[model samples]
Target chain A: MDNMEDNIKCVTCTAPVNIAVIKYWGKRDEELVLPVNSSVSVTLDQAQLRAKTTVMASPSFPNDRMWLNGKEQSMDSKRIQNLLNEIKQWRKEKHNGDTCTDGLLMWKVHICSENNFPTAAGLASSAAGYACLAYSLAKLYNVEGDLSAIARRGSGSACRSMYGGFVEWDMGSQEDGSDSVSRQIASENHWPELRVLLLVVSDQQKSMGSTEGMQATLKTSQLMDRRIQCVPESVEKIKEAILKKDFKTFAEITMKDSNQFHAVCLDSCPPIFYLTDVSKQIIQLVHAFNSSCGITKVAYTFDAGPNACLYLLEEDVGRVLSLICHFFPPDKDDLNTFVQGLQTPSISPLKVLLWT
Target chain B: MDNMEDNIKCVTCTAPVNIAVIKYWGKRDEELVLPVNSSVSVTLDQAQLRAKTTVMASPSFPNDRMWLNGKEQSMDSKRIQNLLNEIKQWRKEKHNGDTCTDGLLMWKVHICSENNFPTAAGLASSAAGYACLAYSLAKLYNVEGDLSAIARRGSGSACRSMYGGFVEWDMGSQEDGSDSVSRQIASENHWPELRVLLLVVSDQQKSMGSTEGMQATLKTSQLMDRRIQCVPESVEKIKEAILKKDFKTFAEITMKDSNQFHAVCLDSCPPIFYLTDVSKQIIQLVHAFNSSCGITKVAYTFDAGPNACLYLLEEDVGRVLSLICHFFPPDKDDLNTFVQGLQTPSISPLKVLLWT
Candidate 1:
């Protein structure tokens, strides 16, 4: 939807979700959404999980309005306000007298965003949502070049979703978070053998949002101090692993960092628990599965929820999926929609004794 | 029983369980069961949970034999063998000419032990068992003085169980762990206002024993290095809190240390999870209850198992217990034994909005 009307302008964009392999937890700068440490993320396929948004600017509107997944959501949040103001200001300054869309810059805007997947069950819906919002607004106002930094003002991890495939959020030294933008290290086509399986364990909204949870961890967890120092080195290692296509090294670091991130969550005062018994069982299954295979055939990373995001090679996907099906059989009625993602070659269910 | 018949002398002793608030997780010396850092523990009332051990020495006995819960247990474990050898050696050295008891030291011994509560479910059963064994054997051989250090050889936490109330296991600088003995900070009578409620959530034998679990955390968890440095200062703060009878400070430290210990477990590679959903729910309940009351009324700590050991003041015990019972109802058949500990003053359950 790129057509421009007489007094109103509209643009629609879609952004995919990304799971941080080396996570971004606590924030050094709250307003700017700057991270305490650099992080690495892998963008998921948009076909399975994404946020579709349409931004319309019109002289007829009174003020900024937002509608999320059909329901109207307040745009009064400081994060959202700052994001919209910053983008509009950037457009007004950068494209002062553009012939076609100049009048639309001063006009009020309405944002309608919807996620194909669940919203706040920690599937990184906000990342996709904010990235989509930023991308659409930028495109509508004729703002070109990298908008990752602008996208990050809405959500810290949102910046990573701005790029496809593997991305890195550099924890910039600037207090204003100018260098905290995420850039793609490799496109989706770089790793042809890589495959992912998104296991939707729970669709229920998370009890504590990431922002509040991060604050709790930062204040209460003494271990977080060490984690801050511990992350940068791993970011480099995972990057190297990503480029070399070293699945074993990548898998090892991914699982370790995810566990470490949650460990910090649990270490917080009034400890934040995002993982359920099913999440833990999935973890045990992965370890046992790897031990049984005599190699790291699969790796699992969880976000701020119980759902499990498994990454593995294409060849191993069949055997692993069969093992998963053998253990966690789909509900009788919802069997067709159970394993939703990029299609994997179907193989007969395998007998796996991988209980640890 | 304390009796001497024929050429046999027997002594029975009981020891109460202790829950470490500071936590004794990793060991600097595995063989000696020496901890990497100092810890503080509170001994629970023996009436609620205890291990009774009977040690007998007889010239007719061919070798040392042991029975646990009516089942014969091999004395092949190094910890048992080392404990027995050390005690006999000490007895032979100190009581060479103690006429009646002197001859008993030359004979082989038969040891039988049993715990009133579940074993290997993180109830500190091992602490009670080892303490009881050391006490009864010491009595049989007429070996006097503190057996806390000797008990430590069997299990690191056993040293703390030798005391009646609040105890501290100092992480002695000596490599031999000679100075790492536990001492009573305050007796059970010191805080008559203190009360405890033990929730036996799960008696399932833990997948990983504390010894092996500690090793894994020590090796893989980077945060553990920071935790080692962070604990000693809190140990001092908690000790001060205990001496001052400052429930708030003591409660805060107790809960923080418990969370940190479990956090390290989660941080480990192929992470270990001791707290179940029930345990986590209990944690949330405690926090919510404290917030609702505008004070820290209760503090909960978990060992390697999912069971919750809640510490609160005697005045607040009824309210807290009622809250616990409200959230967690007992099975019809097991209703009578649901809340087991020192008898609390019965009061009406107060209406509480503690679901956080």
Candidate 2:
């Protein structure tokens, strides 16, 4: 009653993470899912997506019970089941020398994930989720490997999630993907003045998932090869720019890379359009505003989603925020809510005001 | 005829033609206006633009009279006046060598041009109009030197109009542009079955002129170098494809080149958006229709404007026409008016329908 009943209770693990400045686009191997080029990312403070997971081994449970974000999902999917089975097998192999099981090992795993903001708001939730899942599971089961290596199996971008601050995923040449792992460049504390504003333009789910869309692009796009080859140089330059705190170079590279990524999406054989009219309008307005102000004060980046994440220097935060508010003026009733939400406590003491 | 009466009289010349498959985008030198790459084009049977010229050399005529299209344009503009003065000087030199000036330098030129379509339709009207004007004036006054060389002075692309069939503009490396000239690739009779459908999306003038836009892009765009360097290979491949009558390769190259050109436009520092929503929609619809049909039947190309030119194999012309008709159905009242204009003797037995 003691051991058997105690095993029925669930245990949980959780991890929080950030976004990549340099994007990861194509995969070298689909099975191992090694990327074709190295990528660099920055982990944000006071803004993150967390993934909480609980894994339990029970003698009485007939099958695995899994829940994601309070909703029960089918463990009937072979992929999830396979991963769970592998974790159990690793645990058993670690403690017991012989493989003799009277019944299938039963475990209940629950994941209650939440983001400070919206899920599909271009904040790289999947990157954080898969990275957290792989890291937490490996720790819980005592998996014999580096956390980054294990995370790579979950998602190519997940490898970069194992580290806390600036991380790089070096795309290795090994067939087994043993060399492909995330390496830390700088910690989050290194760049305290840097602030990112997640501008939620539209909360609609993306029309195309990154995985399927990227795979389609790789298969059919003539521009894919050129983009993959061209982006590495951009990544290298961005790394240097960040190290030197050259905001001008950093902003230029980030914008160019984003544009090039979207260009590849458009140049795909069937064409995948991730940018809406609103997104295009935002880009135009941002450039116009920058030129009008005679300063490169703010920089914007977008992922697979239509939302924009603007990065501003500490000195220019107030002005850029004001511009943003003026451009996206709130409705009469929502003016206060909008202004309160837009204020950046990290950079400015003065609060942002939104006119109805 | 008396010199006084001749001065009062006006002689006008008008010649209109159409553009072919080959496109000319960049120039090596602004002064000589040499192209950076060779291009091939086809001359259309149904000319849509014309150049009208009236020459009067009598003492009574003051200055150069030039009404471009319907408006009385400034011949005093340095560019226009310089060209006219050069032609006059060349005629005077020719007259000095001849005893009778009547056979040679009898006229000063006044030119008025109009397009049956719109000027900003991306139909290469300027190329044809300028070329025709140069050629007609040269013939009228018995000017010396090759007509191609003289036409090149009017407009870089105008040199190609000297021939009525398939023309290739050889982008020579010479500083003086002595070697840069348009050569005939194939006679009009070579591919008589080939046909092009011009779909006029918008007749509004482009925000940026082609020459200005190209210069801006060359100086500001990071992608410009890549485009200029990469396109030569594509151009070579397209030439081979066209020569071999390889529609698949030709279509692929054409689409890629057009996309790259547009990409370069977007990559410009200020960003030039020549494509409208309708243009993008047409591209997407055409691709979807072709892919769904499981055949590559029709290809579309865009110049500096939002208008599209659909190129189809002669065999698939009827099907493509029907598909276009289905998408843009003709109104009953307008259908009669359209058909009345289609009564030209050269009109094919194929029904003519306008796509709005």
Chain B TM-score of candidate 2 stands at 0.83
Best by DockQ: 1
| Residue range with the least summed lDDT across 10 consecutive positions in model 1 chain B | B347-356
Each candidate's lDDT (Cα)?
0.85, 0.64
Q: For residues A1-356, write the lDDT of model 2, one tens digit per residue.
A: 11235555444555555566777877878777788678887665533345555555556656556666666777785435444555566667766635635232434454444445445444566666667667556655555766676667666787787777678898888998879988888776666667666666676887788878888778865556766777778878888888787877877777766776676666566566666656666677778777887776666667887777666676666677766666666557655445334345342221232110
Please report, as a value between 0 and 1, the fraction of native contacts recovered by candidate 2. Answer: 0.09
True contacts kept of 1: 0.96
Residues B1-356, model 1: lDDT tens digits: 77997878989999988888999899999988889999999988777688999998899999989999889999998989878877777776785533536556668989999988657444658898999999888888777766988899898899899988899999899987789999988888888788777777777888899999999999999999999999999999999999999999999999999999999999999899999898999999999999999999899988888878788887787778777778887677665555444555563332211110
User: What is the DockQ score, from 0 to 1, of model 1?
Assistant: 0.87
User: How far out, in Å, is residue B56 in model 2?
Assistant: 5.3
The top-ranked prediction according to TM-score is 1
How much TM-score does chain B earn in each model? 0.92, 0.83
TM value for model 2:
0.82
